[model samples]
Target: MFLDRVADNFLTQLVSEPTREGAPLDLLFTNREGLVSHVMVGGCLGKSDHEMIEFLIRGEVRRGVSRTATLDFQRADFGLFRSLVDRVPWEAVLKGKGVQESWTFFKKEILKAQEQAVPMCRKTSRKGRRLTWLNREIWLELRKKKRVYDLWKKGQATQEDYKDVMSNKRRAKGNLHPLLDVGGNIVTKDEEKAEVLNAFFASVFNSKTSCSQDTQPPELKDRDREQNEAPIMQGEMVTDLLHHLDTHESMGPDGIHSRVLRDLVEVLTKPLSIIYYRIIES
Candidate 1:
């Protein structure tokens, strides 16, 4: 209950906190970009709200709290359930008709968090004339905590979720056609086009009747020369150079362009991986 109180207080602080610096508060739980946060509640059965709260706290701390993110109660409750043994008050809370009704509202929310594999917590609010399991404050605070949903939200990703998503995205991306760069313009392929009609319209109506091909820009030509002339560096060296370019003090157009070229060249020129180990007698 102490942890629940802390969770409540934390939620209250986030919701009541005045908007400063012209940033608006986030009211919706969509988990998109913005100033305000969206929290969730989740957990399995047979766990205390405190255990749920602790899991959330630990999760949020690990994930990095931000003004833009938060947790949903349904999700939080699930984490609580997973962390504790069956026989806690959580199950009792679901015993009564009123409690079951309360559970109905959160059922979808619980399912969503599990599907996404995010940490969850259990929450309880003032049970009175007007049922209030989760309020704006608690919702806001959950969003403020960040780590609980960090992996859950893509924007909502818990750290692992983020990595897993990125890995999948990367793997999926590997199947995707390489980004096509024609001259200096960025153009999405027909396959990536969101709407087929819009894509067709762009192809037929928006396209220029006759456009001259741009001569290779001086910057690009120089890059081409460097790529052509430079000997292939070892994988480790290429990675080190990439790190250096990325972390350079002056991060500007030139630096970014160089880094991109370096990375691309490294990828293009690197030899295929071969796994061979020599046997040695001790």
Candidate 2:
């Protein structure tokens, strides 16, 4: 359960930074549903991005169990934690030159921590086991529970009413959450699973491209919109054509005939004419 909390905190906070150094950065948890919560990173060097994350992840796992928490402590099944980790595009996002090097070191460190936690499991878990099947089932159960919750919310069920129903269901099953069933035998439908996977990757590549004045340098933010309306053409010659088209008089300051002029240029200057123009007022 704390692993779930840790993973949730990671995604909710860490993914937005373009660089690792940007993490361990202060995060604002403002969701009205009370799902948003903050966890501070402690006992960290707080010097580099990777160090901070490792500190946070390790801290979450070991929190409040220090007497029991040792290099020999049995880590909670890596299943829950790994699921959360997989949702992050760690490899793809960290492909930057500096990050890649840091990541290599980070992975080794993480694996070492894993080894320290459960030395025997570290050795045997590599051969793989039947537990993967169980984990899959658990994920499926979670999907189903999520769907039911979604429908109830959509039906405008009151939070108290929904909680009561969920509580009854939990009691009948003797489980806290069906999605997190200990047995892990719930089968997930393909579509719902795909949606969850898609949302994760979408979040991975989803940096804000819109250069807001507050966030981006003012000059960089507005240049593309104010200058070129035409899409860039590829190839050396084709690129020239884009520039030529931009500069062509037909697309000049104002012209009812502008559209026609552009069409004509496209046809007549099919090879030689390349529009290179910036729409800047003199």
Candidate 3:
């Protein structure tokens, strides 16, 4: 029954002539949507007898342009940031507050500090094509090769010249192969490659289960957990953590860079520790 319906709907012929000398072939098909507006049949290339078919798809489809907010680290002023933090009356503002209140107040102060210190700029996203290995030299070589190939195609260059340029182009492409997995296998398909990469990273970043299993025995786990969950974060510990922060790391959505925190660590450690204790208690 399904075969009869399909035959009734799709058996209608679109092409009028045989692609070759004999045996008429209907290579193109279109439904009621009219996705393919028109078709062109032309002579085959070289010594081939089959006709070349060109389908014209209706309407235009374009990719969406993406933009991202990025911090202007080059124009940042760390000295001004220190002054901004110093101006804040953290003791008076955050005193006599519950954990949530203290956290909210601390966040507000940090935001204020960020506004004064960091500037943000919006730019079109690069579509993730800015690979570390795709440098200017390689791009220039690729452009040169493309120009030579185009010239050869237009009959301005000889076969030898075209082959040489193509060889160089292939070598440039070989340098930009897909990323290898931890098992040293080259992932080819885009979806499979992305899944492999995401799975590997997920295992690395998800440390809760792994840490509990490896670091704590069943008998002492509860006691160790209690100790680990102690409310008070020492000022020295906060300062040490701040000092270890990478200054070159990118800023978060709040526009606060590690450089800002690192610079004002001495002034912020005590107040931050108080807030941390409040949050823990809450």
Candidate 4:
């Protein structure tokens, strides 16, 4: 009677072997076919009446490779990083050091702190992935429907039926919220959406591109130099540049984003000067 109630689409009894004296007690069930295969039985272990059951699980498993290391900023503990940097006596550390030496010391310490505060995570590849809304039960229903159709084609059934095989709720919600324009109007046309993206990509910072008389940094002053040799980098310029960095912009190849640089301006200014110093020297 229980087997009569269950449709051919629903429960699939995977384990066919009888565990104790011709009574099939040990069981395994899966709604989707071909998931569990090669049902095997072995002799029972010491003091155990139930025999060992072995089966291979087969399915669409995506073993992603080519992972990339990236900073997970959400989990970063900036307070820990700041405390680590503050515990050091910078004045003593950079007492008699040159620009390069001082920068090196700061870089070492900051990197050490950053390692613990912002640990790296391996980014998973999305080459071949399913949509967020598509789940396992939906997939099983699709397969069941397909099997019912095949059975009907072969004249094996009088009436074939399956329902609830697809879902569009998420897609309906997605369509409800379309792309908006600058003035907060929903854009429906493809051309309008394209225009919005083009406008965003073409936009640049509104800040001044050049320095006028009032804003020009004081000329670099380095006494230890050959004739006509460029002056050494000043801390003021480095600080100014860090301050002007647009937080909205994403990070470059160095993995250091504008927001992080601006946030750590005080600690990074001197070390950043060394970076510019080498550039000018080169």
Measured on C-alpha atoms, candidate 3 has an lDDT of 0.70
Clashing residue pairs, candidate 2? 142-179, 241-274, 241-275, 242-275, 243-275, 243-276, 244-274, 244-275, 244-276, 245-275
Q: What ordering of candidates by TM-score runs from best to worst?
A: 3, 4, 2, 1
TM-score of each: 0.13, 0.17, 0.41, 0.36
- Which stretches of model 3 miss by more than 4 angstroms? 1-24, 32-38, 44-50, 55-81, 98-100, 115-240, 247-259, 273-282
Question: TM-score winner among the candidates?
Answer: 3
Residue pairs with backbone overlap in model 3: none
- Which candidate order results from sorting by lDDT in descending order? 3, 4, 2, 1
lDDT of 1 by residue, 58-90 (tens): 123353323422233334343333333222233
Tens digits of per-residue lDDT for model 2 on 1-282? 955875666543433332335443444332233343343343446554343322123223432322222122244444433343344444344333353354454444345434433333232332234343344446676686677678777985567766775686578432121121124333245555455556656765676534546684546454435433432322233333333443223222321122222333333232211121111221
Which 10-residue window of candidate 3 scores lowest in summed lDDT?
Answer: 222-231
Candidate 1 overall lDDT versus native: 0.36
Q: Give Cα-based local distance difference scores for all models.
A: 0.36, 0.39, 0.70, 0.67
Off by over 4 Å in 4: 1-59, 127-236, 246-259, 270-282
For candidate 3, lDDT tens digit of each residue in 8-84?
88743366667877656646666546667567777887887788777787877775564666666568787787787
Provide the lowest-lDDT 10-residue window in model 1. Answer: 273-282
The Cα error of candidate 3 at residue 105, in Å, is 1.3
